[model samples]
Target: MKAVIINTSTDSELVSADVVELSNEFNTFAQKTAESILAMGLTVAKAKRLSASDFETFCKLIRYESDSSAIRKLEQIGKRYDALHRHVDKLPSAWTTIYRLCTLDDSAIDASAASGALNPTIKGSDLIALCGAAKSSRGAKNAKSTTARAPADSAVPNGTDMVVRFTTTIDETQIVTLRRVCKLLREVDAEIALSNKLDAVLNQAVEMKEAA
Candidate 1:
């Protein structure tokens, strides 16, 4: 060509675009690699006979602390991956979302996906809340089933009014302590009633005051 049209600016723009594309590819590859590693670690953990301390050592060697949130979640996923992996593609990128999905069965996972519960608009905590609701519903169903199966031996006698009963929630330690306290209170009340001990103590105090 008689006049060489050298648009250096155009060449520079093309090079910059290529660099951006390459960077994006690298980032994608890195993310995929990280996901694979996490999945592999979870899968191998199933058969590993390592104790808590040994596992912590392994996690440290792998640069993820044993007690780290990420490791804890990955362990949960690993333990239930067989049931969970079927719906993995529908899960959000967050580990929390993945962990929530792991708690559910395939049917629940499919239903949630169909309802778009795992979409970007919904969050991991929202999915966990849904799981909680599902669990409560299941518990209610189980309670109903148990009530329906009550044996004749559990029925109250004809003349005996049903013993006054109320349900209350208590932790294991609280329940144990409450039982012991109730037993002690009953024993003390019986001893006091039999001896008229409280009346005697009050009478003695009044006499001592009059003497003073």
Candidate 2:
């Protein structure tokens, strides 16, 4: 059909390179970041991906912001959707959730639709915006930004003892609320229970590193 042709044309240039190679770069970034973020005990559970277009979501999370102010600021930057966030309990901060939404994008609508199917418009920063925008992107909206970044040491010295590495396994609303209060994760907090998970990943990483 004509729509299919348009879908093919959208990319202008299809991904000439292997998708796996493209993913490798992201995987490398994730693993390396794990080392630094994990030091803060900001593992996968407490941390979550955030969506960009949900300005309301960003602002609400920002209002209740905490130690990692940089993350709030990073939300302002742009990238493609499905950018995964390595969320920790109150360490790497909250809005890192937005980052998760950045790296994981999957929107494929009909090309015949007037809104335009197949996300070819997404490229560069605009692409990033798509990731963020996609969060609420009901009509194939891509709201998360998944651009790989090597953030400078935001780790607090001796932070490990004070906090255990944990990722967000907490259930939060897909939509953010305004005038929300930020909750700081206390040492060995029972609610954000990630001690077990953290122990698991750490040992696995060590073994892998040793094997490597």
Give the winner by lDDT. Answer: 1
Q: What's model 2's overall lDDT?
A: 0.34
- Candidate achieving the largest TM-score: 1
Model 1 Cα lDDT, one tens digit per residue, 14-72: 22332233223323433433244346435435423454544443443345665677666
lDDT by residue (19-62, candidate 2, tens digit) is 22322322343432323333222212112232232322223222
List the candidates' TM-scores in order: 0.47, 0.18
Misplaced by over 4 Å in model 2 are 1-41, 44-66, 71-126, 132-136, 139-212
Off by over 4 Å in 1: 1-41, 51-54, 105-107, 119-121, 150-212
lDDT of 2 at 101: 34
